[model samples]
Target: MGSSSLSRWLRPEVYPLFAAVGVAVGICGFQLVRNICINPEVRVNKEARAAGILENFTEGERYAEHSLRKFVRNRSPEIMPSINGYFTDPK
Candidate 1:
């Protein structure tokens, strides 16, 4: 890679564009894979949808009953809660 091209890519305005493009590509890939493989509806017929007959395991596994899920749900949705708490602590 030449310095000219590297410098062009490294500019401040160029980063948000790159980040946005990267995010868009990632989301598109994820959606495509999910629809093709993970989504059971992709294999189901219109009659199944109309009849409300789908996989029962999907509903059961959608929400986990594990202790970690419950613990996280009740806590603040922070990336680094411990670090945030440490900085904000009075003690």
Candidate 2:
């Protein structure tokens, strides 16, 4: 087949594939933005506070401090050896 004929045959098939890929990319981008922009914990805390269900600012402050402390504790050097052992063999 001539180059012109091949191009003619392939051009029609390529468009729908490109359109589907574009739609998939757009969906993934939206999900990425939603995940980054929406903090579920903060949203819930704000809603609860607005509803008068939360008594004081100290509640959220305490939760935040506890989460930070837990995160730091998990990352301590003493924990690394056990974490690394999970990937290695017994021998």
Candidate 3:
């Protein structure tokens, strides 16, 4: 009974499902951490918000923008930036 149950749980066909679940969980965890720690619009103080924190920021402008966006904005998009820069740089 133990072997049968273990074999059923360890089937090769179930690996994809496990991979998908793991990817989904990783994405959820990343988003949760980002929202809690870095998202500017998540105000913890109701009073401060009411008083004037980010009052001038428009709704569209309030969302936290990833620093990567700014870094890539002026540069041409590349699949591997470090490698591209390494080869292209003058010695």
TM-score of structure candidate 2? 0.34
* Rank list by lDDT: 3, 1, 2
Model 1 score (lDDT): 0.74
Which scores greater on TM-score, model 1 or model 2? 1
| Ten residues in sequence with the least summed lDDT for candidate 1 | 58-67
After superposing candidate 2 on the true structure, give the runs of residues whose Cα lies further than 4 Å from its correct spot: 1-10, 41-91
TM-scores of all candidate predictions against the true structure: 0.49, 0.34, 0.52
lDDT of 3 at 73: 85
Model 1's TM-score against the true structure: 0.49
lDDT to native, each model: 0.74, 0.66, 0.76
lDDT of 3 by residue, 1-91 (tens): 9999999988999999999999999999999987766566665667756765565455435453456767778987789989988999988
When superposed on Cα atoms, how far off is each prediction in RMSD? 5.7, 10.6, 6.1
The residue pairs found clashing in candidate 1 are none
Better candidate number, 1 or 3, judged by lDDT: 3
Please give, for residues 1-91, the per-residue lDDT of candidate 2 as tens digits: 6999878757877889979989999999987775555533344445554765435567556645666577777564655777687777476
